[model samples]
Target: MNPLTRFLSELQEVSLLIWRAFISIFSYPRYYAETIKQMDLIGVGSLPIVLLTGFFTGGVLVLQVFPTLQYYSIQNEAGNSVATSLIRELGPVLSALMVSGRIGAAISAELGSMVVSQQIDAMRALGTDPIRRLVLPRIFSLVVMLPLLTVACDILGLIGGGVVASSIYNQDYHVFATSVRVGISTSDLVSGLIKPLFFGLIIGAVACHKGLSTTGGTAGVGRSTTDAVVIASIWVIIFDFFLSKALQYLLDLGQL
Candidate 1:
């Protein structure tokens, strides 16, 4: 198939997969146990990296913007820059990217291996819908855990900014905190918080689809894993752009 046609086909399959996963939520057996396991794997397993990444990202942002702010004689409002940047963009996007790299790759690899090994076929032979048994659990876990992870990233990023402010810039913590408080708004925070949900959905859907569609052999599993991470990460960024635009439009209309 032509590349464009192949892309459209892939999009249709993933969309249908997402729809089925959503519909499966209301079906019986609910797969609570599988979901809990996935949550632990995707959420808890990812916390350390998220925290570390968030902290460093905040510090770097503050440092990067300091010269510009200082040139404009607004050095005291460093926390304002950090707060808005982390809350509105960096925290959610970066966290989602990280999750896509880690969890996305893992999900695809696991499922792809299962597919290659005929385990998924066995499950289907037993009359269990793989969408309900596998995809839904992963989708549910990511949708629930990603926002929570983003919140943690936002909070840690702020703390990291404060540390940089006090240690490197010799600014007082109270001033930094006050600046962040005065500079941030409810709408900004809400928009940032809301982005991870869609990002999570995109990641889960892409990863699961790649895994389920794996062909060839172990080599195909590796390829699917890599594609899942790259595609999910790209989709998160693409969705983030649209989400940001939509949020800005809503804010302009005083709806958010």
Candidate 2:
């Protein structure tokens, strides 16, 4: 097949998978146990890395921006800049990226393994819909967990930035905290939270699609895992841009 044809074919398959998962979500026999298990795996299991990423990102932002602000005698605004950036963009984007690397790869590998081993087919033969039994739990878990993770990232990022600002720039911690609180608005918070929902959907859908479509053998599993991370990360970034624009427009309309 030509590259465009292949791309279009893959896109259609992914869309159908997403739609099936969506429909299955409202059906009977909801997999609450599996969903909870996935939540723990994708959310609690990911806490440490998310916290570390948020901390370092905030610290690095302050480290890079503080000197410039200091030189301009506007160092006090550092908190505003850090907080605004984190709440508006960095928190959701970085959290999603981190989760995509961790959860996305794992999902792909596990499902790919099941596919190769025929366990997925076995489940289907035993009268289970794999989309409901497997994909729904993951998709639901991601949707629930990602926003919570983003909140954690936003909070930790601000704290990290404040610590760095106070320690390195000799700024008051109280002032930094106050500036952060003042800098972030309701719209910013909402946008940050909203972005993660779409991101989680993208990650779960792409990972599941790659896993279910795996060919070859163990090598195919590895390829699917790698593709899941790369593709999900790229789509997260692409969607983030459009989501941000659409959200900003909606928020602007709300003020009118």
Which candidate has the top score in lDDT?
A: 2
Q: Give every collision pair in model 1.
A: none
Q: Candidate 2: which pairs clash?
A: none
| TM-score, candidate number 1 | 0.97
Candidate 1 on 2-116: residue-level lDDT in tens? 9999999999999999999999888697888899999999899999999998999989988888778889989888998898889899999999999999999999999999999
Across 99-180, the per-residue lDDT of candidate 2 in tens digits comes to: 9999999999999999999999999999999999999999889999999999999889988998899888889998888888
TM-score, each model? 0.97, 0.97
Residue 28 alpha-carbon offset, candidate 1, angstroms: 0.5
In model 2, how large is the Cα lDDT of residue 143? Answer: 92
User: Which residue runs of candidate 2 sit more than 4 Å off their true CA positions?
Assistant: 253-256
Candidate 1: clashing residue pairs, number: 0
Error of 2 at 91 (Å): 0.6
In model 2, how large is the Cα lDDT of residue 256? 19
In model 1, where do residues sit more than 4 Å from their true spots? 253-256
